[model samples]
Each structure stands twice: as structure tokens, then as C-alpha cells.
Target: MTSQARRKKVAWGITGAGHYLTESFDLFVQFKDTFGVEVSITTFVSRAAEEVARVYGLFHYLQTISPGDYMEEVILESAQGWSYPKTGRFSRGNYDALFISPTTSNTVAKIAYGIADSLITNAVAHAIKGGIPVFLVPVDIEGRIESPVPYFINRDICVGCERCQEACPHDAINEQIDYLKCTGCGLCKDICDYNAIQGGQVMLVVRDIDKQNVKRLRKMERITVLDDPSQLERALRNVLTEEAG
Candidate 1:
């Protein structure tokens, strides 16, 4: 095999994964074949995450690697340190970066605050030890840091079911909700019918994919806020593209 064609990978680790399962799934399909570098995505679903994935058709799009076949093969079958999904071997010798897209505000604060309750958070901490690059897409409407687009909005009437309270992954919702702390992805507001929920977008931060290099990635931002298989391809391609010139 030609050295250029030989595969070198940048492993991606996705968590809070339920929220963006469909997004993640589509991302793999769009780039996996074109890039030739394996686009492995791990869905770290607990019982709750699984339910969301099923309801939202996330599992359907992620069938191959979602631990069940109801979903499709666009998603790869991978696992975390504990049984989860991964793109390639992430051991000491396998990866170039660690990225978590759609990073929940809970996840962002936890990592920034030193909380490692789940697989993704734990991995982020681990990445630092090896000088690994870590990118993040923390979804929080908290304080209007800045936004690429307005958040999802609800135009219907209000039922006040408080059903949204049950769906919150971070217990951030309450009768008197704090918009600042909210990522505004609208998971809760979307499920409601009375239009009780409001608008705002989750923050998008690319934790590990270096921004200077992101230009080479074809359509990276749309898939998952944090991960982009094309980003890895660009990095790899640049190696020879630079050499060729």
C-alpha cells in the first residue's frame, strides 16, 4: 500500500451523545467513505440516553455501532474504556486527538471544574496527560457568550406540563429557569406541546480540533459541534499536500 493511502487516524470520542446521535450518525455517513480514515463514533448511552436515541431516530442512524442493529451501519461499532464506541485504537499509540462534540454544559463545567462522572469526561482528563488535543462543543445558552445562529424557538401556546423537567440531563430546568445556564438545544422545549419552553442555542466549542487547522476540514461543523472526521482527513492530507508542493 502506498504510504499516502495507508491509514493514519484521529480517534473521536463522543459523549452527551444522546442529544446529537442523529447528527453524529449523519456525520459518519457523509465522510467515512470519502476520507478512508475510519470514522468511529461511540455512543455512551445509559438507559436514558438509549431511550432518547430511539425516540429521536438516533439509534436508527447509528445501528452498526450503537450496540443494537435497529440503527444503521453508518455508525461504527465501538466502545469506550468500558463498553462504548470508538473510531480506532485509543491506547497510548493509536490516536492524535480527543474531541467531544455537543458537549453538554454539564459536561463542560464538569471538565473545567474537575468533575469526571462519565466516560467522555474521564477521557478528556486522560487526554491532557499525554499532551493529546481535546476539543469541546459545550452546549449552553448561559450568559450569551456568543452564537453562530439563534437558538431553536417555540411558537405554540403554553400547557405548563413540566414534562421538560423530566427530560433535563442536568437538572438545570426549574419553574424559574435560568436562561444563562441553559445550553438551549431545546430538547426539553421541543418535546413539550404547550410552548412552555423558550429559545437559545447551545454553545459550540471545538475542544481539540485546532482552529488554525480546521480550514482543511470539509464540512466539519455541521456534523457534531465537537467532532469532524474530515478534520482528521485534512490534517492527514496536508501532510502529503505539503510534501507534494
Candidate 2:
């Protein structure tokens, strides 16, 4: 009888940024499907990421993509407490590598400054302390990017009836959409009688401060900074190969 090769375990983290959320998830699915025999993945999703994923209509896909075959588990921040006890696994060397893709600027700054309040940031901290290689694909790494706007209100089409506001469960709809409060539930859009609610893509210019944060993260030890999410496959392949060797 022939024995199967050991699968490399990876910890994948997702933040709230919508810039490359879909792309990252697609790549993740591809990696697992293509390299299931050689690598296994466990996904860690932040609380904000859950909301953003719903907004983009990818939340269900994220949950089902890893059915305990190629992917091991999907850990959610909402399911964890303030201390995030699951993150202790990283410190225990439970994973071979940690990869965070479509990472938001907020997350990048927090990690660069050593803040570990959130689940994703806490995982990165513990992973680094445990000597696990950390790879991040920051959404705001480039000077400019075309990002998807999950929801928006058109003033010209809105009748000020406030129906959309009343239908919003998250209180995300006021004078405008407060993205932080929104979960992309589409309640406001559904209740809007004026057809003012809309969604599309928009061009965003990266801030100087965010670029500097990426620079700082790049200088951090044991960390690999990637400007594009597409580069993640190559990076992960290289790491797994090196580890196997």
C-alpha cells in the first residue's frame, strides 16, 4: 500500500474590504480545488468581513466553498468572544502559513502598529510570534483602484419618503449610506419606492497614509506584502514547496 503525502495546513484570513474580496475568494476556491491533495486551508473571517461579504452577495459562497474536504474549517469572528481563543492555535504552530487577502487599510494599519484587537489582526500577531510566515494582499497598496460600491442612494430619484430608512435594520441608511453600519442586506433597496438605491463600481485613490502603512508592513519580519491578490497563488505555492522540501 502507498501512503498519501502530508497536506500543508494554511490559515486564510479575510477582512472587510470589498476591493478584492471576490477575487480573493475565487482564488481561494481555485487553490483548494487544484491543490487539495497537497494543501489544506482553514478560513478565518472578521466580523466586518462577514458584513462586507453579505453586501457583495458572496457570504453564502464563502461558507460552502470549504466543505471539510479540501478546506478544514471556517472560523467567524462573530462566533468568537473578545479574547478570540481560536487565535491561540497560531501561537501553537497549528498552521504552516497565514495568508490575508483583500486586507483593508484599517486592518493593515492595526497590524503595522501591533494592534491585536480584531480577530484577523490577533491571528497575525500570534502567527508572527509563533514564527509562521504571514502573507498579506493589501487592497490599498496601489495609488489608485477601481472598487465596487455595494450600495448608494441617488438624490435625484429619492422622494424623501424615508421608507428605505425604515426598512434598514442596521440603521445604515440616513442622509447617506454609512458603510460601517451596513451589512449589504439590501433591505433599503427593496423598500425604496423611488428606485433611488443603486450599486456599481467606483474609482478610489489610495491615501498617502495607507501607502505608508503598507510600506511599514513590508518592512516587518516574516511578513510578505503583495500588491495584487493574483500574486497570492504563486506565493502560497512557493511557500508550500519550500516547506515540503
Candidate 3:
């Protein structure tokens, strides 16, 4: 009821591993106060990351002001060497937009290749279908490249544990890097939890905010959750009711 949770709210969609969620939450804390601006984030996580998020304290903070709870949230379903989540809840038309942060190389690949077998990917495909704006921020992965500049791999850090490839939900992680399929979702790093993986150049950015920049928004003193179905429904019904009256 205080200013910490007041003002206009924007619907946010965060999907990936637990680490990205934590870093993103920390980033939001930096923008708690601003002029005529309030930002809020609500997210859904992979089943495995959910436990990590709980162990990492990310879960407690996220629940205090759930954008709409699991009823509106979802579990992602991955594939092959990785696990996936049930993703349709976030993809539904009610929410304003979607963002998959700390997007891993594999998640990026899924998006880049139009793989929609699971929830997040399916939703990503669907968001595009509706001409909705979708944002991605994959955690940096350390590896080789040949984008006319020969992106080299340290290999020294490569323990050959193969866990990253094992964690990919989209079957996109390959021994040899392929930029075309990598969408930068950051799942490998989040699942590692042991700091075993480093991301390649992933995708991330700020959108939906007004003239002001919102690289951070958790500490906002005035954030209003606008996606509440009741409120939206009421507002729409009022428009019709007023005309009838």
C-alpha cells in the first residue's frame, strides 16, 4: 500500500534459469525511483530453475507481488539434452509483452530457428504471430566464432563436463557454435548454479517504458500492476456500459 508499490505497472515476462531472474531483479532495484515512471516484472521459470530460484531468494521477492500468479504464469518445457517448460500462460493475449532474459545459447537458437515445441518457444513464435514485440537477453556464453573476425574459444575453461549442452531444452547446443540458432536465453548458466558456464553475446534490452530508461525497476516506490484481469475487464466493460447508459 505504500509508494514502493505504486504507479502505473507494465506487464513483464521473464523466462529462463534462476540466475538471470536474480540478476534481472537486482537490475530492477536500481530504478526504484524515477520521474513519472514505474516498472514491474513478473516471470515464469523452468521447473529445475524454480528450485534454484527458491534456494537463491529470488522466489520470495517475486511472490510478494505476483503479476497474476501461476494462473497467469507457466512452466517451460525444454527438449533433447535439456529440459523444457510449459509456456502458454505467458503467451496468452492478456499480458502486454514478453521477455526471456539470460537467454542461453540454446534458447536463442530455438527462437532464431522458429522451434516452438515447448511453452516459451511456442509463445515466442505466437507473440511474433500476433505482431507483438518480444525481447531477449541471453547470458554471455564463452566460445569460438567466425563472424569474419574468428571468435575464438578459451577452451582452457572448458572442463568438457558437457553440462551446458546437457541442460539445453531445445537440442540446440552443439560442440561447434552456430550463431544462427542461438537466441541467447541463458538457461545453461542459470542451471549450472556452480558458475561453470559463460555465455556468448546474448540478446537483452529495455522496452515498454516511456521516454525514461528502465535498465532497473524493482525498487520503484510507485508501481501499479496493470494486467489484473479484474481491472482490465472492468475498464473494458465500463467503456461498453457507458455507451449503453
Q: lDDT winner among the candidates?
A: 2
Which of candidates 1 and 2 reaches a greater TM-score? 2
How much lDDT does each candidate structure score? Answer: 0.45, 0.86, 0.42
Assess candidate 2 and give its TM-score to the true structure: 0.82
Candidate 2 C-alpha lDDT tens digits along 169-226:
8887888988767777788888887779999889999999999999999999889998
Q: Model 1: per-residue lDDT, tens digit, 1-245?
A: 35454343344444444344445556544544454333333333433333444434344444444333221122222323444333223335344555555455455555655555566656655556545556554444233333333232343555556777777665656764444344445677677776655543455554343332332222332222334333443443343233211
Q: Name the better of 1 and 3 by lDDT.
A: 1
**Candidate that beats the other on TM-score, 2 or 3, i.e. the better one:** 2
- Off-target runs (Cα >4 Å) in candidate 3 are 1-21, 28-41, 65-92, 141-245
Taking all chains together, each candidate's TM-score versus the true structure is 0.46, 0.82, 0.42
Task: List, residue by residue over 1-245, the lDDT tens digit for candidate 3.
Answer: 34554433223344445335555555433322231134343454544444445434355555543434433333333222243323333345434445555454445455555576545566566666654445555433323221111122236666666776787665556774343343345666666545655543433332233112122221122222222123332332222223111
Alpha carbon lDDT at 2, candidate 2: 19
